[model samples]
Target: MNKTVFITGASSGIGRAAAQLFLQQGWNVAATMRTPDKEKVLTGANLKLLQLDVTDSNSIEAAIREAIVHFGQIDVLINNAGYGSVGIFEAFTPEQIHRQFDTNVFGLMNVTAQMLPHFRKNKRGTIINVASIGGKVTFPLYSLYHSSKWAVEGFSESLHYELRNLGIKVKIVEPGVIKTDFYSRSQDMINDENLEEYQHYLKTVFNNTQSSGTNGESPEVVAKAIYKAATDGSKKLRYPVGSPANWLLPLRKLLPESWFFAIVRSNVEKGL
Candidate 1:
């Protein structure tokens, strides 16, 4: 029997790419997004679209129930529905902070928690949490986004040990700067009434983000990594995709704290 894969954020970018790739591999795909109908790439009798929003429990629950009803058993899940919260840390109000976590950290867990019963019953499944290189290293003006990804990394790691005996696996995909709508979709909080004082750092960070977003690898690169994690049946904990992401893993470990910070500060903050 062909395995069924459920993916979030299927309307665009990496999630969209993954859906296409899995479909090509002859796997059953449950592609969910805020607007699934907008996806022109998803086709075939095996494709099912679920209207899903990770931050909305009701939406997520409905999607899960639908998946269970249709596919009977979900073999893999790609938690990819999230946007970047970019700006100075001081500029992020409590509401803004909550919004960041609500979508990125808590939202991912919410979906995973809802699906665990399904995974546990079968004693087999893969949860591909879309974390980032930011999870491992800090970047200026991305405190909220990076912190959320860091939480994901930690969450996925601990879950691996907890579920391994159950024959389920949890993996993290630490993608580097992929050429996607990630930057264009960031919620900027630089000059909100609550955080007007952090304009200097915010400007520098925003500029850096714009430049980097344009130069990153295609979203397909990360999607391929996610596909591998979903099907490779490896015991490895994390997979870093893309050059910048793979490079960061060692750099963060080998570089001196002061030196690394200096480089980050100069490249990411000095001009601001």
Candidate 2:
């Protein structure tokens, strides 16, 4: 590939899939992960592994420089690093929320800030932000995670408007639940052992996430969407990946607030 792409969280999940896709298409990929050595799957001449933690500013700066040095200049940047911490709102601590935002929201800002000089100098760049349908709507027990995604949505959209006159482009890929380790690795907002206050809601959210996760779409579905949004040269746009997101987003908007929240409450309250 003639273009070089910088992808965060390139070790796993959607980030890994997108990186692999880009590399397979002949693009140079600077894949950074918190534990780059553990990324046994993403190895090749076109790939450069870098150790990066979104929470670490030094790591972000170093990775940006390394990516520019390795690839000449960053044609595209995929902000894909983040984790989900789902649980009842009342059960979440301030620290937990900070950790979530640091990685998902501010971490992304830091990376973008560091890469601006490169993009500005070239006057050409594409930024693809991996947001979620939760960015537009909410689900039970996912307040913190969804909130972060909403921030991503707002930030990316605003940047799209701001940077459009420039040579930069911004797009958001809003995927519905996907079959990723996110569910398995997701932190329990309230641990089952010690968290007894919101037992009912916790059970509801856990059961719902598990049930929905099973039938969710594949990572490739999202990979294809990300590829299009990044390379298509389209202006700021939101591509809702997966049938559920495409269908649900319109429905959620058409429905009244009470109806939507009631439906969410009903579905979540079930099998609790």
Candidate 3:
């Protein structure tokens, strides 16, 4: 029997791309999103669309249960349901901070928790967490987003140690700048009109950030990386995708703290 992969945030971007690729590669796909009814892209005999709001435990439980019933077993779980919140850190309200963590960090944890028992029972499974190069490197106007992804990176790395001996693998897929709805539809920009002091700085950094997305690789690139992590059958943990990530990640590690920060400032805070 073919293996099955359950993906969250499958309505678009990397999640949708991965779902399509896995199906084409002869695997069953449980494509999940907050509004499954709005999705018209993914459809086939081996595809099951599920409604899942990662922040909601009931929704997560229901989606997992439905996926298992439909596919019999889930060989891989992709925690791809997340969004980015950007802007001045000082302007971020308590709710925004909580929202960022709730979706990007807590939500991912919740889904993984729901799947652990099932994965444990099977004794063989892969958990792929969709993180970002930002998890390791930082950029302007994305403090909240960076913190959430950093949590994911740390969480996935630590979880891998415990799961390795259990025949369950934990992998983190870190993409650089993928051309996706994350730049627009999936991004939350924190704006405060009263905080005019950082207006020029914010505009400069935001424009620079947007330009990176404009030149970003297609979501398919990250999807291919995700596929490799799922099927490679190795204990490898981090898979950084996209051209920028290839160089950026290593550079961040090699360069000193001040040097790396300077480089980031030069790029994103050029005009400021």
Index of the highest-TM-score prediction: 3
| lDDT-superior candidate, 2 or 3 | 3
- What TM-score would each prediction reach against the true structure? 0.94, 0.95, 0.98
In model 3, which range of ten residues has the least summed lDDT?
185-194
For candidate 1, the lDDT comes to 0.86
Q: How many residue pairs clash per model?
A: 0, 2, 0
Off by over 4 Å in 3: none
Candidate 1 local lDDT, 120-225, one digit each (tens): 9998999999999989998877788888999999999999899999989888999998988787764444455456576665776778767878899998899899
What TM-score does prediction 3 earn?
Answer: 0.98
Error of 2 at 164 (Å): 0.8
lDDT digits (tens) for residues 15-47 of candidate 2: 999999998888999999999877789878898
lDDT at 240, model 2: 95
lDDT of 1 at 209: 65
